[model samples]
Target: MSGNEISEVAKGFTYLEGPRWHDGRLWFVDFYTCTVNAVNDDGSIEEIAVVDQQPSGLGWLPDGRMLIVSMKDRKILRRETDGSLVEHADISAHCSGHANDMVVAENGQAYVGEFGFDLMGGADHEFANVILVNTDGTSQVVASGLSFPNGMVITPGGKTLIINELFGNKITAFDIEADGTLGNKRDFANFGEIGDEPNVAKRIEAATIVPDGLALDAEGAVWIANTVNQKATRIVEGGKVLEEVNTAPDGIFAVALGGEDGKTLFLCAAPDWDEGARSKAREGRMLATTVDVPHAGRP
Candidate 1:
């Protein structure tokens, strides 16, 4: 499998995000359309659920229920067997901004992150927390003071959780405790230095990279969607860039690995996240390519 020879699997969406392969289909959310859908192998799509507040991430609990992230409402939603959406966990009281991506563990624990500030409103950058939601829907702030913590994945062994610190230009790892709490925060990969600027605007502008969504491979390397660089990068431990796929013009905001053998790399791309342009053109597409390694660990 190589980064070249890209293929378009789906189109006509207003910003696609939170790609996950489950039940032999590609599941994702259309941000502006407010729908969670699954694309089958034959190019047909099925509407699974809808999020009125906007959706960004998707995962599943151990009991086979779907979990969705309601972005603006800062809550995790569970889709019951009756096709109803209910609040699984409300984390708004502990978050400064919108709830974003998430990863569900083997034991049904979910680790979700937030934007940490008014990103679209041009407000100052502030650190946010990662909320851990138990199987029963109880939630707690397991890790905090993070710079825009975005996509996350739990290791196969269920001992570590890797998070993409979007504005921090790095991937951070945390020790996942037996009780579902995160501790011992450390850098897993550092792409570059984040500038120290009093002005929040300048600080963000100085960032060399912004890692958004990520997917872990069987070899322990993570394929990251670089928001600022407009590329999908494969990075292992120690900050090494093993490979990169250019998305140019359109930014690759999310990535997922899955297919019959779990080697297909799915990408979510749009010209930009501007609501005005995305809603008008609906140019978001789900592009894919095969990779050398198969997907591993939790989604």
Candidate 2:
């Protein structure tokens, strides 16, 4: 869809992230607002849950229980049938930065990511790890040596896992073993050049493709939040741009393909990434446009 064709389905938030289309609704988390909300098919919004410490990613368990990433506290809270939030796992001991996004597999295995360093605080850069949260509430570091792992998706058949390394400027993949372990780590789609600088600000200013959130299409193409260019770029297995949808006036933070026909490309956008400025205002929005390919694979 063109920039002019994109419509705002919902507005009035700080910063929206982790866009998920499930059960006929578009669910997401508002960072500064500290709320988990969903916009129904009728255009009415609903407050599904609340995350005081700040919420990022959203996923569902095998039995259909909601799993929310409590960012600052470094814990995964599971919503029970009675609407109570309980700690599913504590990952602070295994992480140096706040927990970020997560992807739950078909077998109830959840892979999560973190900053690995203090980004907002202007700390030095460091490679992060992907923690695997089992169904029994046990957590382990499944994959390491990542430059800020953000949004991820498991293939439709659950054989491979694709991850967007935000600070690394590359789309990486891992072979999902039969035992729920990740092996054969390789760059699925990598492009641009950020140089060899480890200085966070210096590298970010020099980076070419700073990927944030991403979604997989039906044809194996990946729609990524190209933060460096502030648009959603569609790429195949190789680092080739198939299409670029501009979300001007606002930067696209996340992309998801979901709707009745699964062609609705939902874009999580904001005016800027200034946490101080964003936290004081509700300028965040959930914009969307229809595309040809529907959503596939795990969110």
Candidate 3:
């Protein structure tokens, strides 16, 4: 699919995040609205669950349950069959910042990222990190000293994991061990140099790009939501930018590959103003494009 011909799937949301193809529907989060919504194949939208805390990320357990990332309360929430939310994991112990986006593995292990420091509005802080949480309720920090870790994905073979560092303007990779541990951290792709000149880092909010929300295509390419630039970019295995698809003027927070054939790319975009005038007007909206490949790994 060419970037010039991509189309929009749905709109009219406030701060949308965490879009995943589950149960034949498009499941996502509206952070400002504090609700989890699903867009059915027939184009009908439905609210699936609600949480007081702002939901930032979404994932599924091995048994088909949903795991949501709650930012305000700093917790991972699990949605029960009866449609109630439960404390699946408390990550405040290892996270200096709030929890953001997450990716789950086949063994039921979820890799979550944190703001490390307040990026949105809580506090002026720094340092982002990644943590590992199991379905059994055990949690641990797998990587640290990161500058606002955001989006993440485990490769199809499950041998490696890639994370985006918002302030760093780079994608970092780690070797995934059989026990769900991370090692050998290295830069996978560098969006641009980190210093002052209006580059990738200066475009998006700190820790909003590199790791905001990400998806993997069937060809093993990583589709990154370029938050600052308001675009979706495809990166090959060697950290090369293959294509860049422009989105709305708002910040592009996350991206997901879904659709019947898994060729549709969904984007979670939101409006963000300067700190002092931060108001939620048109906060979240869903943008989409058609791609040539399907989503990699499990949906």
Candidate 4:
């Protein structure tokens, strides 16, 4: 509950990511296992949906239906009331690589990002686009020229959107326009000094602040999951580190603030989630810790 003290809540998964707290439960996606799952307070877990190509982000439409990011095929799938999965939007043609994470708005619109290159094959870096998928199943490239945009969130007032660029080593901010377009792009926080590393994979490996996922707190600060160093950092908009927590054996991919009082910080973590390694083992875990500030903003 204080000073990096954390306890295990759930375990046995093949790489967990895109965690969220919705409907009084914690929801997440197991990338290698290809399933969307939920865990309740009673230590019971339920499979909510299955994604053949794998799933990442989790959110809900204004109508209460669920929206899932189908990573491989670059599609967003929506679950209906009767538990049927339907294609909401196709972003395969728009993205340079596999889609990763998303943030759904209260109006049912979503902003999604992709890898921007063949990462596993060790391809070089290529800027990716953040696609805006409308509620009616139409899509458009809202923001472009990003270095692997990963986790994202809309501010509590819905006026700003913050996105974590994994390889870029910074969190980018955008002004949310009325028409669902992103503008006024700027660096919200600089986790560390990023240099020109010709090798994309090596850049990520060398960077100390390789942020993956993010969670906004009521104090207007963001908690970042630094995948490279296996640490979680709480930083303000101008990049001041307020607090940090370390996960030694396993690395954290994503985080969510949830619980009865919204004080629990749930972390999605696993032991080295490279494609070859994670596919062969199920060592993912959901860890939780208490914090002083409650959650704020969207999932």
For all candidates in order, the CA lDDT equals 0.88, 0.88, 0.77, 0.88
Q: Tens digits of per-residue lDDT for model 3 on 149-259?
A: 878888887888988777777888899998999999888877564544333324345433454678888888888887767788888866777877786577677889887
TM-scores for all predictions: 0.96, 0.97, 0.89, 0.97
lDDT of 2 by residue, 1-299 (tens): 45437889899889999999887788999998889999976898898889999999899998999999999999999999998999999988778898999989988899999999888887889889999899888999989889899989999999999999888878999999998889999988987656456797676776667788889999999998887577888899978878888977689888888988989888889887778988999999998888888899988
Q: Clash pairs of candidate 2? A: none
As a whole number from 0 to 100, the lDDT of residue 32 in candidate 4 is 87
> What lDDT would candidate 2 get against the real structure?
0.88
For candidate 4, lDDT tens digit of each residue in 95-195? Answer: 88999999998898999999989888778888889999999999999999888899898999899999998898889999999989999999889756566
Where is model 2 poorest over a 10-residue stretch in terms of lDDT?
192-201
Off by more than 4 A, model 4:
192-196
CA-only RMSD, every prediction = 1.6, 1.3, 3.2, 1.4
Cα lDDT tens digits, model 1, 1-299, are 23488899889999999999998889999998899999976899889988999998889888899999999989999999999999999989878899999998988889999888888777777888899989888888999878889889888999999999888878999998889998899999986667444355565577656788899999999999887577899999888888888878889999999998999999999887777778778799999988889999988
Q: Evaluate residue 194 in candidate 4 and report its C-alpha lDDT on the 0 to 100 scale.
A: 60
